[model samples]
Target: MSGPPTASEDAPIRVLLADDHDLVRTGFRAILGVEPGVEVVGEARDGDEAVQQAQRLEPDVVLMDVQMPGVDGLEATRRILGPSSPTSEVRVVILTTFDREDYLFEALQAGASGFLLKNASADDLVEAVRIAARGDALLSPEVTRRVIARFSTPGPAVQPRRPPELTDREFEVLVLLARGATNAEIAGELYLGETTVKTHVSRVLMKLGLRDRTQAVIYAYENGVVAPNGPSRDGSET
Candidate 1:
């Protein structure tokens, strides 16, 4: 898909581009606008404005650049994603050129669900956003394996461990679910029927004491049940 589903053909996937550079926002708007189902709803020059506009417009997604004046991407991400973050569930994807480890970790900790380079292709941008809108982390799909590997440290291997209560199959579903894979997507990936997948997801959610799939994903990371960079649907599975 070009972007998140719009209300109608004439409608568009509402998007907000948050970056410090004028040219950067302009280029993003142009690329996203040309793609079907996508529209640049608004643009912000800094993180403060980004948060303000997010409060006002409540767009479907925020294509946020990591480095900006006043509030940098990391802090902005934290503020917007804070406990008081808008109830609209607006997803934030970091669109930055820096592969700096510090920013990467911070963004993840701050609750950003996806990360992409400034030079990301128009198609990738569109999909990244579309997937994020579904409440899945876009990190594994877009970031390189090197980035994933970096987090897979071996000093005693202390990544979050799988929850003791979850069965193997339940754990698998949890990963896919947290990664934003739909029930059908999880069924295809795990070789189960959609109905079966739903049962497993429901059971997993209950067992994990989670409110929903989004919390499952955050728990998966915080507990190291799945590495932040694990095999996931980048639209690879239906």
Candidate 2:
């Protein structure tokens, strides 16, 4: 199966800066200025403006600050990635000074592709935009473990529900994905082409009605498809 297509090299990744701080936006612009194959197409001072500009500019990625005057980043992200948005192709990466776990969970639920720290290096910022633009997630290995550990534990919210029927191959892919495996890694492990892995990923997202990879990971955990630190049939850690 062919995977979801990534961004092509022919066009630069257009980005929209959505932050309440003027200095933050300026700093982001300055940082992204030196990066090749990236362009800042617009800026927004609040979540409402962010949503409006997202529709108008149709940027490939949005650098959304978690805190804004009105609507806030979480709501803006939801609206931007929601079904009624002008384009569902756009991706958002949440930026925040606080590394609160709740913020990360909420951002993912709001359809954000990643969570980035405000103090992250310029290189990190540049790389994050590139990753998000390519329809890939930006979760770090540490964050991945944290997310799994947190979500895998039983809770009133973690009610078990049946997942959509997936083929055995697709189930394997989802388990590895929840375990933080990259497409390339999964390809090597499964002895399939990278494009085929992508296709499987796209199918998984489609069948699961998920927006992106991050949601798929959460779904796997919530649906009991995999457990925190559990071993799989193939002897792989979940």
Candidate 3:
């Protein structure tokens, strides 16, 4: 309930907590304990220790906080995920008090698999780790919209209102998909079968020349599909 596991779990997600405050880590541990899945593998007082623990513990997820003492969270993230010799894939999820758009972009650029506001619900933190562990980027709808609004190029990117190739349903699915909704969630929202939603997702990815949902989300954002302050979907609102 408090975090990912210190050791291996039946759920197979080991988690490490990195924050400057001991009380914050304890609170996170208490909150994460009630969850059926997830466990707290270890804790670190700063970014450097976080990186070292990440290497040693090799947790499936690292809940990292920004603005730490030496080495800072973003730099630590870069070190962990950068071209290095870590045997395990140490997925990092930036969890911070701030909700700055710059932090979001910088975290993503630093090889973070996910970014979560510190105010995120327990459910969201859990789901974000799960999604990132599954190799998908975890973007909140608000985060996604901000990525769009801050980076969109307008006419050149949307002159023709998107290519005529995508079907209406496909386009709708793409928008939702890019908004960070999982296939199951999107299916429920759209009243479609999971398999059908998967098909639409796949088609959108292929047609848009995207490598995966994360890139597709970035594409949609940078192309004006979603805007900052727009309605939030994808179970990722504040």
The global Cα lDDT (0 to 1) of model 3 is 0.71
lDDT of 2 at 25: 99
lDDT string, candidate 1, 1-238, tens digits: 1222223345566888999999988888888888887778899988988888888887878888888889877777788777566723567888866558778767766767678778878889888877776545564533434344544566455445667888888978877765667788888888999989978987887787553454566566556666654533222221
What TM-score do all the candidates reach, one by one?
Answer: 0.71, 0.87, 0.67
Best model number under TM-score = 2
Off by over 4 Å in 3: 1-9, 83-88, 153-176, 179-193, 196-212, 219-238
Model 1 spans > 4 angstroms off: 1-11, 141-151, 154-168, 175-189, 194-218, 221-238
For candidate 3, the TM-score is 0.67
Cα-based lDDT at residue 91, candidate 1 = 75
Index of the highest-lDDT prediction: 2
Give the alpha carbon lDDT tens digit for every residue of 1-238 in model 2.
2333356798888899999999999999999977889989999999999999989988889999987986899889889888666756688989976467787888888778887888999989999998898888887786688788787667764443445577889988988888889999999989999999999988888888786788888887877677687755445676
- Candidate 3 residue-wise lDDT at 160: 19
Clashing pairs in 2: 2-199, 3-198, 3-199
Go through the candidates in order and give each one's C-alpha lDDT: 0.71, 0.83, 0.71
lDDT of 3 by residue, 1-238 (tens): 0121232446656778999988878987787766667778899999899888988887888889988898888888888877554722577888865556677778776667677778888788778777766656666666665666655434444321453568878877877766568888899888999999978877776677553565666766656565434532232331
